[model samples]
Target: MKKQLTAIFISLLFFQLSISAVEPMKPQEFKADIIIYGGTSAAITAAVQATRMKKTVIIVSPDRHLGGLSASGLGFTDTGNKGVIGGLAREFYHRVYLHYQDKQSWPWQQQTEYGNKGQGTPAIDGTDRTMWIFEPHVAEQIMEDFVKENTLKIYRDELLNRESGVLMKNGNILAITTLSGKKFIGKVFIDTTYEGDLMAAAKVSYHVGREANTTYGENWNGVQTLVFQHQHHFATKIDPYKIPGDKKSGLLAGISNETPSPNGTADDKLQAYCFRMCLTNVPENRVAFPKPDRYNLLDYELLVRVFNSGWKALFNKYDPLPNRKTDTNNHGPFSTDYIGMNYDYPEASYQRRKEIIAAHENYQKGLMYFMATDPRIPKDLQQQLNTWGLAKDEFKDNGNWPHQIYVREARRMIGAFVMSENEVLGKKEVPKPIGMGSYSLDSHHTQRYVTPEGYVQNEGDIGVKAPKPYGISYNAIVPKITECKNLLVPICISSSHIAYGSVRMEPVFMILGESAATAASLAIDNRTAVQEVNYNQLKTLLLKQKQTLNWNGKP
Candidate 1:
């Protein structure tokens, strides 16, 4: 008994000592051939492709989950055409397929009886391919497997020091200091954040809002009052005013009440933002939405008003992923979108980012809690919502809440090539194809405004189908031929804002990520800048990797 007590006491002491030994954000240095800054689908693709090329790679992500939205709960991929998906990105969905081969994976669907709805490049449910729609944790597990098999090094929760921290020497990044003061050294770097935080820190030129239509000769660019997509049209077509016909009631919670005049003028505003909530009806895996501490009922006054306006189609955008869970997102006006509220997020600091996150959480939680329990909602809609809850098996951390919020649109870098509407609509072909996108140019719920009659209306949610599988440009991944010369990119970093609207699909990002990795490796081998890398050589390499080139390339 005495010996056991001594052992237990010594164990406790060791545990405490080990815990104390962890220095508070030490500036440790490490070397790698490539240093990827995010756990996004593109980042993973880059890292995996680099490993295949025998280049040492590491992913330094501030978050623990990998594959960004792909792994974070966006299993219902927003791909426009599956034909454009290929290489590592397609392989990912194949792995997702393998996971479902086991009967145990289908807790809701009967094994061998479930209908397969496979489409796109990987055909999410094809016999030889893995399914695309997946739970958050399953995506994480796949990423972990990829990392483990390739011996890819990943440092989780390593935050970037947004200012004066990432040290670039002679046009090439030498070292980056994280917020915790850890230093990471690499030959080449890729910025994969939805916010482009690291790229901005590196002094890359980027735009934050929709450009006026004249900026890129883009017909669909800027001030798109005439072409709203999706289904978030305001019910009353309210005018942006405060007093109704009297024009005296202060403008509602949203609306840049005054429309900006410059056709292509840039602004510090973006589309909409929402948490990709993971929900389930399985009793064993359901977690009730927790009403946050600062739950202001008044913040949702517009939503309450919206509900009262008879717009109670609650299941409009509850998109399902794998594992009987859903990547439930915002739909019509007054839905889950936090419009006109995230204008400052692109350039905000950590504390500021947290503030926005908290505010969004409050807005979303209150919205859900309202839908499920609010007395004002229609009886049938409320009853339907009551059947849903956060999936117990997904996002096991953070109370099953999705770790990623859809940024929709943010800072887009003007790179070696800027993709425009012409390239997207195939009015003209993009010169160098590195990737493809097929999702309709989809943005979601931006605002609510007061009408001429004192009623409210919604705006900004758009969803336009493209003509075909449009090729994404390789130059979109690199800084201007005159700007930083050693970088390669894929995470919605290149292209004009409207062009990015269609190019920002997850499968496309993964394809671009693989292509970016290929370019980065080639640049390293040839001792040349990313902009100077031979396109023909890059194209050949991509073709070898099963990437569809020229759109007409054979499968």
Candidate 2:
């Protein structure tokens, strides 16, 4: 039997070789004018736009899934105005509208039961251009439609070539490789990831942490202890000390390695990351949380303590989208924001990243289990947790857990120009307006701490309202002309920490994605590098393509 199996393996290898020989290497093996390196909403739209302009484009997706946050559990888009979102971004919503047309599409809801009358939502044919509401599966189906319609080539689960792979000649990218050793070559590259990995690997300058207010002379750029919008946590100042006003209780778990400076000097600390889970009453798609390897009970002791402390808003953060489903998020202090644990995640290798992901899953799942099953948990909170389960219809592969965590912030590229708080507040004028972000200058929980007075405290969670719709410059998307002549438009936006808070929404990503593709196509057409592409020509093309270059600018 062993000899027979070995012979079969040998035959399979020979068959694969035969197939490879038939497909001989062309001079530009799988060459595209634009090669995007993500499966994000922004990446897909960018590639689709390039394709629309008759440019051959391919997406080398590191993730197994497509449509990063948009297809993930972020269904309730944080878009300020539907008018501000246009181009392929609006088309994506239109596709979502199309998905709900068929009765079979409603696996969770009957078509007749699901009403079509929408306010300000664009239907497939622009009949009901109202609020865009969809389930995870619906979004995925629509994203699949976009790809099929455009005939875009996508290589899924392909890890990128970080070290010696990106072959560059005179500031132009020739080709990039995957860890499995697949090559994807293209002309203009779009770095549409939340983490900006490809851009960093290509030796682009980027930043990981917050900058001081002094660095940019901006008001919002600092380690502010001020609780502005949601002042629920800081009703009273709590102390970090263990002995209640004593000097030495040490610190709680997950505090930063760096000293806490008030000036917000560039520390590696970032806002929290959590899996935006989709939950339902269905059981078949829900997988129980196994007792994870390296599962530590001490990691969840704090959560148990929080439950005992009378915090029972487990579902408080759930944002409803469509089909009677929810896009659930982290609610309160120490809920789902794996605080201070993902510091090394942005730059870690795949193996290390997986380990961290497991740890996070274990932490979050163990917290839920501890709350639901542990006798120490408050009776009411435990009862509430027992009422919830993973949604059957979503993430059929990963037990309905979101594939991409809501990585609120990561390595923001320090490009030709940094979009600081000044740009968002109209203090500094954006030279070339590619897109506008109108979402509140919002930030998720940043740190969990033991106060000096012996109580738990969560700091740096901000929800500042934007004064008005703000303009984002194209300069933030490109590296310094000296660093690389090519454009690396981050769908997650490129800015200082505070500025990124507003620019990090899914709709903003779509907007930025469309603009990036327009610029890429224009650069290719003009026979110039992205850095040298005339802004005036790019602007003309963007307006012609139905992008919102001119904002409504209303508060």
Candidate 3:
């Protein structure tokens, strides 16, 4: 009986092993020549460029949507000097122009009736056949078209397993695993993420918040407690206490009590973030602002005070888009920006980041609901706001809210080279020119604090204009050889806070993305590390691809 029992046990064990052998393995690992992360415009452009170079590439995207802010209701393109835009960045705008040529593209309005106005420039450049301003859905469709045309494989909603996902050997990443156990193996990696998650995961050097002005010898790199270049600051002194001047009443919802450091000092604070809301006046295509479930009347009490102080620029940033829509951004003090609420967002865990994003959404939506329905607001302002509602046709997936939040700034890699205000202002010679940026060195409010005079005020609203277009260094996107050999960061390039202010535009991100991929493909062909890629050959390829490397034209 013992022998028979033993024989039966051995047979059952073999049967189980055979069953396991036939069972399907955990989903096959995705392998490609290049693995591009992030779902921003830069990721799409990089994937397209890699494919054009005849390399197998895949986009491992955390976002389901394609375009970042471009498709997230920033219809008013911030093209400071449109002449400097080239390569796939210019191609994107050309496609936008092509899209508008079709009368069917204008669903809510006629093509002839659509105004060609943009931010201080014509939205449609007839001479170049490029359209700068575009609706959110239009931008998304164009990005999708690029993917479909290139036949690029994109794994959507795949979150990187930041803790232990990166497999490396001798400073080279072998593969990256996502939270769902999906593995992506690649020869080269491009981190186009706004938060630089992959770059941080690879143990690369990076800096969060701002550097001291002395760190990079930049005048605008650090704390600007009194610098109010923009109109985002309060027009008049207002009490910061909940009970208006009662010291024991405590500070209001958004005001901070910490005495700000001296001007030009470094701090671990970030520029404010807000959703570039797409609102429309069309009754049929408008959804009234829905008050959040946890709405608090006191949250916007400061805004009410602003209104009572004769502030009238509430709608200054209600920039127009096609189809009678508006790309509503943060306007005057206490508008859409959730100031000082996102200080930890750059390094926050995924769960924590989501909560932060949710908080921002709630704050912004609540602000709008308050403006449109609250009796404390001026009647004329409320009436004007009531006429506009969320665009019904835009962002249908998330209650017509933009899928992306404007991450004005984030983790910046301290890579092989650092671009600074010197390069942006054409004060220093940039090396290994890859692309150009002409946007102003702009930063939104970073803190809302009580002034020494015992009044509420906003700080760190900077907008120093770039004198002319300047080259972005190839080394700025490359990591040090010892840190990591295979990763490239385009969106969060190596730059001081002041320089990144100029580099952190959507068009410029796309430009850097294309250039990074071109260099990546060359590196793969030569079997060399990204840092060792030949600059002459890279420059040849970039120019052939029509990237504007140097600018001799007027700004």
TM per candidate comes to 0.90, 0.87, 0.96
lDDT (10s digit) by residue, model 3, range 34-62? 99989999999999999999999999999
lDDT to native, each model: 0.75, 0.72, 0.92
- Tens digits of per-residue lDDT for model 2 on 276-297? 7676543454444445446666
Show the colliding residue pairs in model 3.
none
lDDT score, residue 66, model 2? 89
Candidates by TM-score, descending order: 3, 1, 2
Model 3, residue 374: distance off in Å is 0.7
Off by over 4 Å in 2: 1-28, 101-128, 226-228, 231-252, 255-259, 282-294, 553-555
Please give the RMSD to the true structure for each candidate, in Å: 4.9, 4.9, 3.7
Q: Write the per-residue lDDT of candidate 1 for residues 366-451, one digit (tens) a residue.
A: 88987777787788888888888988877766777778877777788877778887788888878788777766666664445543
- Residue 158 lDDT in candidate 3: 97
Query: How good is model 3 by TM-score?
Result: 0.96
Instruction: Report the candidate with higher lDDT, 1 versus 2.
Output: 1
Off by over 4 Å in 3: 1-27
Identify the candidate with maximal TM-score: 3
- When 1 and 3 are scored with lDDT, the better candidate is 3
